[model samples]
Target: MSTQLSEDEIIQKISGNDLTIGSCASQALTYIGNKCGYDVRDFRGADSRWLFGQYTTSQKIAEAGGFVECDYNGFKIADRLLRNVEEGKEYFYTSGEHAAIIRKTGKKFEYLETQSKHIDENGFHPLTVNVLKKRFRTTKTRKLEGEKFLQKEVLIETSKISDSPNFKELLGYLNTDPKNQKREVPK
Candidate 1:
């Protein structure tokens, strides 16, 4: 039997079943992967709740040939969702403690989420809009190093120390105290 499911099939699975206990991230990832012809079980383990890290989930989606966009702007998210729909690509949106799969049908956007609280008679509600501003405005003292600098930033922003095992390790490597660092001696 073909593992790939149509959009309607996925929607029926979401609406008809009770997924109130699992992690929203895993549910969204599973829905997106299944719809796009990938097996979510391979990436997410038996207990889906344990795979709640956004960065890890994003990596899995990318590995499955899907695109991931991380941004705090709601308008940008909406625009990207529309663009992805136009291109017939599957995408997921993650913010704070919640994640959801976005779909476009005839110019209208719809969401399929596992959390019953997030869904109502009208379907999934849009995330709250919050404009994130940097608390400190300062020029960069030095350029970032490493090949995965950008990827590391995304990982840090999405992964929490409690949920993601690699979060603390990555943060420790990235966050170094300038005062404690040994400066190079001038020749």
Candidate 2:
């Protein structure tokens, strides 16, 4: 049976553990996935490419259909964590070269990460978080060389709708194509 662990419980379980190191992000993701009734082996298998070659943690998660990428201002990381995240969904946060997981529980957030020396008891915070979701395919059109026609590349891009207050505004602006912009007069 799967047991959903509280933030404190997760922290306690990982604190001072030697497994806390470079694989911390993967470990946290595995814990969350297992609790959510996903097969831990599937997650590990998707994350295993690191042993044979180089692939980003986010890339692995995307391949596993575990999370979707969304946009948020890095400056509002703390506010977004408290206001936007939902319970039972796993969030992946990355800053520069480091990555971690942030899980929401009962109106609060719990951060988890692994790194060399020890597990971060102080909690891990990253600039961005990707929430778990089902995967979907997206198509992008590109110009083909030596031909007047354009070609479409069907890519399995990770995508999500943002929950931020400004999300709608951003979406509206993004939906307006460049041709539409030129047709509209400035106020």
Candidate 3:
């Protein structure tokens, strides 16, 4: 199998994709789901928590099958997932304001700002939690942790978000047709 991207490389890969607002949810689902090997299927029906893309954001959504969740702002997710992150694992952090994927690298934690516009590079930023006091902050320097409790609301297991589809499946529409049907996606 091919080697995975180093953390630095992953930051570089997603830094300048030009994917901006309203795309965060979709981008999060696809990139994380693909990297973590989630099932990543399309969910369409009543009680469909699928966020964005419908017949709307066709190009992006088709490739990734849309970001599925009830809360786009992530208010519902943040309160539950942001605490108790352990080492060697990846987590998806969310709040009413923003969402990003975070992981542990030894004593420090790094995150991917997946939804920023290409020109605004907020990729692979680091965060340090004051676990002793139940608070966290973005570390500016090794010795300096910026602010306190800077509004991260929750964290979710990345692979557990198994419904996001992407990679070769990206940049086009999803192919959810019967196998017997003979046609390529996005024809």
Q: Which candidate is the best by lDDT?
A: 3
Ranking, TM-score, top scorer first: 3, 1, 2
Stronger candidate by lDDT (1 vs 2): 1
Residue 74's lDDT within candidate 3 is 34
Residue 59, candidate 2: C-alpha displacement in angstroms:
0.7
Q: Tens digit of lDDT per residue, candidate 2, span 49-91? A: 2431223435544343333333232223334334545666656
Q: Model 1 residue 49 lDDT?
A: 35
Compose the digit string of candidate 3's lDDT tens values, residues 32-130. 544643333222211222333332333233233223233322333332344456687676554333345677777776766643334344455665333
How does each model score on TM-score?
0.42, 0.37, 0.44
Taking the candidates one at a time, how many backbone clashes does each contain? 0, 3, 7
Report RMSD (Å) for each prediction in the order shown: 16.4, 18.8, 12.7
Q: Model 2, stretches more than 4 Å misplaced?
A: 2-4, 17-21, 37-53, 64-89, 103-111, 114-120, 124-187
Tell me model 1's lDDT, rounded to 2 decimals: 0.38
| 114-180 per-residue lDDT for model 1 (tens digits) | 4333233223433323311121111122134732222111111121222344433322222123223
Q: What C-alpha lDDT does candidate 3 achieve relative to the native structure?
A: 0.41
Once model 2 is optimally superposed onto the true structure by TM-score, how far is the C-alpha of residue 77 displaced, in angstroms? 13
| Candidate 2 vs candidate 3, lDDT winner | 3
